[model samples]
Target: MIKTSFISKTVSELKPSGIRRFFDLAANMEGVISLGVGEPDFVTSWSVREAAILSLEQGHTSYTANAGLLELRREIADYMHKSFEVTYNPADEIIVTVGASQAIDIALRATVSPGEEVLIVEPSFVSYAPLVMLAGGIAKTIQTANENEFKLMPQQLEEAITPNTKAIMLCSPNNPTGTQLGKEDLIKLSQIVKKHDLLVISDEIYSELAYDESYTSMAAIEEMRERTIVINGFSKGFAMTGWRLGFVCAPADIASAMLKIHQYTMMCASTMAQYAALEALKNGGSDVEEMRSSYRRRRNYIVKSFNEIGLDCHTPGGAFYAFPSIRLTGLSSEEFAEKLLMEEKVAVVPGNVFGDSGEGHIRCSYATSMDQLQEAVKRIGRFIEKYKVE
Candidate 1:
């Protein structure tokens, strides 16, 4: 009998993703309307797919360079410059990764050392803290609030920093909260980061979806180009979630270090996906704009509906998510989500899974169809009325 525990304590003690738990439950149920997952509903644009199909037809099936193809890197460079006004050298400052998730993982692994700490802005993505822990760093959180629109405050960031702090991970067009930090917000944070000589891992995955203002890269900030590592990909904006392609851009030294880790760990992103992403950068702008327009419309409708239904939602600046307060039901986030799912057949992620600051809210992905959203809102309103504290 094999009774020995093979799993390391670090991994064994790690909690499973709360987002996936509800998603899996919804998957097993019949007639469920799920707003749990963060994936886009849009199909990969035809031109992007065609490029991959052609690459496969032409028998380009071998592994790419460890840092990805130079051509794709060049296109990515151009896109970064044009879109976000940041410049990266295609030769040494960029690496194409399997997905934005992988890009984030490698970034954390390369930079964080054992017992060192990384500050995470909470009400953010589920992956940040776990990745930091897996990288042998402590994940200290700076919790944002609904009162501040979930934006990380400069004072909050300053208070969270300590002697052991090495870096801060930021997700703008943040997951769950859908908060997008403007240039002024980032500049304020950057001043403190510079003062403390800390590194920044800026995840700009949803940059193309910003509705109210232009998306600003932390790397674009004055004097921040050297310290910021930009993580972005085709998944969110290009509707290419399955393509599994993302990239990282940093200063030459940091990019070189991350590339060594990538060389040993990932080798390269998919060659076919790289070609497809090239097409996405070159020609998929209109497709992205069309999808963004649809999401903006849905965002407007859902936020208004949640407010009218007494959920007290704030309008999110970017990302296709609506994080609404469910405190009126006098239930914890998990209880609210579970009851809503069981009684209403509508699936949402309990916000507390994101971090402690998310306790009173629930995350609903508005990336699904408007009809599903409309129906889900009705079900949620019914569920809320049944349990309203008043």
Candidate 2:
């Protein structure tokens, strides 16, 4: 054998996402009601998809700049300026990646050296910790409680920072939790980050989906802007997940470093996808607003349904998920999920999949339709009422 040990220990320690195994199981099973994945149920808007098709038809199929199409980057800059009041010199301040997922990976890989620490607030999306590890960074998770509405507190963030810290991976309008940070929290964090002279990888993929107030970007903070790399994409808000279009807006220096890594790894995001994303950014406001409204309706529906059926979930003001305390079942989060799946054929992610703080809870994505949401509730309620926890 040609050196099976060639894989580094840093890579070996990582596990694939726990969310996947359960989702694969649900995919194969017949008639399963999965509130499992956080994907948008809707397709990318017709106009956006048409733009991609138009690109292919027009034979604009060649590779774009490793940093991405200049027009798309310019559009992204304008979107930030107009929508979030953040400015970046698109030429060096932005780079388009395969998805926010790729932007995340590249950002971490670029910023983190081996043995450094990256602080993450949990329960967060599954990627942050493993991505940190792959970059030889240690992931230190700071727990956020449901009582605090799953928002990361400044005190908790302060305590988690250490001398070896490289960055804080922040996801607002956060996944699994649907918790969005307000101005006060972001300002507090900005102060702490500035005080410590730390870097911030701000994942704002769900930024446009905020229900209460428009989503806030850390890049909008004057002091934090230079230190922050903003990760967002055309997925959730634009209903364009499979299109694989995401962009990073950061200081030109950081974007330059990230682009170098990206050039060697993946030359560019798909050209057609870039074109489509540009169109979405340029003229897709109504599409985004429509999807956001639909998501809010579903959010309200799930919260009301779960509360009525005894799950004690709050109205998640952002994102498409509801993290409900299944603690009442006396079963741990995983245990509760396992029983629900086996008995009721309803699929929800175990909260602990996000982190230890997620124990005693389960995540149900309300991205499905009103009809399916109603069905999941009935089955789940029946399972909860009849099942015993030991």
Q: Top model by TM-score, which number?
A: 1
Candidate 2, residue 13: how far the Cα is off, in Å: 1.3
Top candidate when judged by lDDT against the true structure: 1
Q: List candidate 2 stretches off by more than 4 Å.
A: 1-4, 388-390
Candidate 1 residue pairs in backbone clash = none
lDDT of 2 at 115: 94
Per-residue lDDT value at 28 in model 2: 83
Residue-level lDDT of model 2, residues 22-118, one tens digit each, is 8987888888999998899988888888999999999999999999999998999999999899998888999999999999999999899999999
Q: lDDT values of the candidates?
A: 0.94, 0.90
TM-score of 2: 0.97
Lowest-sum lDDT 10-residue window in model 1: 1-10
Residues 1-390 of candidate 1 have per-residue lDDT tens digits of 754497788887789888888988889999999998799999999999999999999998999999999999999999999998998999999999999999999999999999999999998788899899999999999999999999999999999999999999999999989999999999999999999999999999999999999999999999999999999999999999998999999999999989989999889999999999999999999999999999999999999999999999999999999999999989999999898888899999999999999999999999999999999999999998899999
C-alpha RMSD values across all candidates: 0.8, 1.5
Query: How many steric clashes between backbone atoms does each model show?
Result: 0, 0
